[model samples]
Target: MKQREYYFDNAKFLLIFFVVFGHFIQSFIKESNSIYALYKVIYTFHMPAFILISGFFAKGIYQQGYIQKYAKKLILPYIIFQLIYSVFYYFLYGKSTFNVEPLNPHWSLWFLISLFFWNMMLLLFAKIKPVFGLVIALLLGLSVGFVDWTTSYLSLTRTFVFFPLFLIGFYMKKEHFIWIRTKKARLTAITTFIIVFIGFYHAPSINYQWLFGSKSYSSLAEDPFQAIFIRLFFYVLSCMMIYCFFACVPNKQYFFTKLGKNTLYVYLLHGFIVRIFRVSDMTDLVNPPKSFILIIAVSFLLTLLLSSSMITSLAQPIIELKITKLQQLQKKWSNLFQGYKAKLFE
Candidate 1:
């Protein structure tokens, strides 16, 4: 019998779990410095890995002209969830969910704005050459360090940070993207990554209070020479580790996979939940071990449960109807703003 393909399950599960685990540790594991250190180590890899895996499966979006399709899939869902989460965040946290902007951009919602630009770039540049497109991704990612993080969202930096990895996923060749056969390259990349990552962890983060400190965001760069090579090196290492982890993973049912499958839902819903629970001092219930473990476990579990219910449980039928309606709305939006060229003309 032919084995069934699992698509990106293992990697997706890892990514979803990391997002929860990283957030929990950042918030709840503060009592232990050792735990905080470990949390930093874990987070160094999460978003990059997620972007790479996203890139790996992106080939289809290149063919059959999935630009419109992608807008619906990623953009619409992003907006839908951002509005929903914003309300929940304020309710939960009892404070503003975002730093005040001149025009007031949502704080965490920058991920959506960044990724939307990324997908658009990929759709445009992937046509030139995959590697060229990857170059564009790097340029976009690096643009972030140059901006004032407080003043506004740096879509360029976010783009540079993630788009290459996304392309790595979208255009990934099973051969080179793997490690078993390319042991030397993978090992070299990983070894360099560890040494450099340690350096970055300790390398002076810019002084935030100084009037000129924000300039450090741009002028200083990732240090030890802030070039494209260093950035690519880390990107490769993250992707390799992800590849190796998935390749060696033992098949087992994991609740996180359910969560990953419904990442859009959690991405949309969880921030508000965090805020709501925080406001109630329910998060204060996370007093050291009990609440620490409780919030971590409950956050992942609840997000998983809610997302699964939306996608698979009795509610999916109703939810699917909603999705269909939204998709139509999405179509209208796509038609209204058809292309960059049209925008210029109008």
Candidate 2:
């Protein structure tokens, strides 16, 4: 078997951590300016970088059964989680009625649907020259904002809005990542991050929703035509931040690096804990400065916990539609029992 690259694995772990951290701090965005700015900064690159990495690994589209493979991987879990989240929200909010709409993904579940669409889209997009294809993707992203109906339903908005990043990743080579890992590049990345954070902090008038790419230009502004330029600006900002993020990611393995392999588990499972926290009285207890520290700690611990073998073992069936982890645990326990039994006999 081919060895996995530590660089990408490290990148995945870090990005997923940011994803968790971003979600946890979202409830407090209105309570603190620092949190709001930080939220905007995180949103600018976290998902886009994640999508780029996914696109980088999507070179296997030509392999047999690729479509079928991702369908089972992405679509199946999306369906399961959609239904589960619906039931979760009904009780969490104490709603008058229960409703489950598979078409409209709930919260972070949009990534799964959008990811699948990105891959399917490669069938056509990949055929065009990379430069032309990217231009087309960008144009579609900008144009989609005009069609008010192109909202989150089916994740259509994001599918187009973010496809350029995905396409860029698809065209990237390992040498490109290697080039960014130089000492000079790393320093520049650090500087870029600081400048971006400070910019967001001072620019409070900028609608953070622009970073989400979920809403239409019409809803975001009275003049929908002008909003297109705003969306274009974000696309540029997100891409710049994404490069800085990639340049700074360490190419070495760490204890948490293995957790990267199970990001899907964290992505799907962390929502339950995050959602419960959001609705509970716990959020009110948090205060600024200190709240930032507390939120980071909670987010880190949550990422670690969800990525643990115990949690993954339990969630594997629903998320991966496989009992492999559970079976491995069972076999491990059986061997341990057999060892003790033989000892007693001896």
Candidate 3:
């Protein structure tokens, strides 16, 4: 197996924790001010940072067999999970349709679909000059208003908005992150985190749309020029917080490395648990004060539980299908077809 970067693994593990934490708090956004503020802070940079790290590790992704590997690991699992979530949603909400739309991803699963598109487009992105690529990605992201493709099902809006962050990671060097360990860099990073955390705490409930990157600029109903600036500001601020988050994270290997390795499993499986919480009215059933603390504690515990090795091991058979067997079966069918054709010609 290839050696792993401890820092990136650590970051991935923590980022997935934030994902679970954020989802858990969504149910309680109106229950507590502190929880709402914490949710905003988590949303601000979690996905951007996660995508950046993905791009960082995706060096040389276009190698001959990579597309095949991604199809098995990313695409196949995306389809399976999408179907699973669709069934879960239908049962929970009593939806009239069990539609599993490939183009329009279900909630949380959007990351998987977006990731697939990003990897597919890697070859195209590699052809552009870095400066030009960055400009185009930003412009396309902000110009979503011009396009009326909501029914496209391909997650075009998010794919464009988050594309720049992915490229930034693609261009990032190990030495770039090394500077964060320096005394001055540490001071600056810590201070920035303080300021941002303070802002999140005192600020009113933020329209999470700014960070979600899923809405069109026109839909926001702000002055066109002002809307453009808001998008740019969120992007810049997210980059800053992402760096600060990495700076503060431990670079040394830890027990969570295995959890990081199986982030895809945690990511896909945890949503099911969260959905159960929502559908059962678990959040509404609980009272404030004691129940609030219980929920917070449970959230962290759930995150840890979801990332545990036991959970990963138990889910592996489902997560990693026996594709080798399928490949052999396909080869056998092809051979039988060839034999039939040759015999007929003779």
RMSD of 3: 9.8
lDDT of 2 by residue, 271-330 (tens): 999989998899889886576788888889889999988889999999888999999988
Rank the models by TM-score, top first: 2, 3, 1
Model 3 misplaced regions, further than 4 Å: 1-4, 285-293, 323-346
TM-score of 1: 0.67
Q: Write the per-residue lDDT of candidate 1 for residues 1-346, one digit (tens) a residue.
A: 1112233564566566656666555565447544444455555566666666666666675556577766666566555555555665555556655433322335455566666666676667777687777666666555544554533444445555666667767776765434443556556655755664465446434121111112324444445235445555555655655555455433445545434566655554455555555456555556755455665677567656656643343333232324553455567667877876697888
Compared with the true structure, the alpha-carbon lDDT of candidate 1 equals 0.54
lDDT of 3: 0.77
Top TM-score: which candidate number?
2
Give lDDT tens digits, candidate 3, residues 83-144: 88788889888899778777678887777778877887777877889898888878877777
Candidate lDDT (C-alpha), each = 0.54, 0.90, 0.77
Residue 270 CA displacement from its true place in model 3, Å: 0.6
Candidate 3: worst-modelled 10 consecutive residues by lDDT: 145-154
Which window of ten consecutive residues has the lowest lDDT sum in model 1?
A: 206-215
Model 1's C-alpha root-mean-square deviation from the true structure amounts to 12.0
TM-score of 3: 0.85
State residue 251's C-alpha deviation in candidate 2, in Å: 1.4
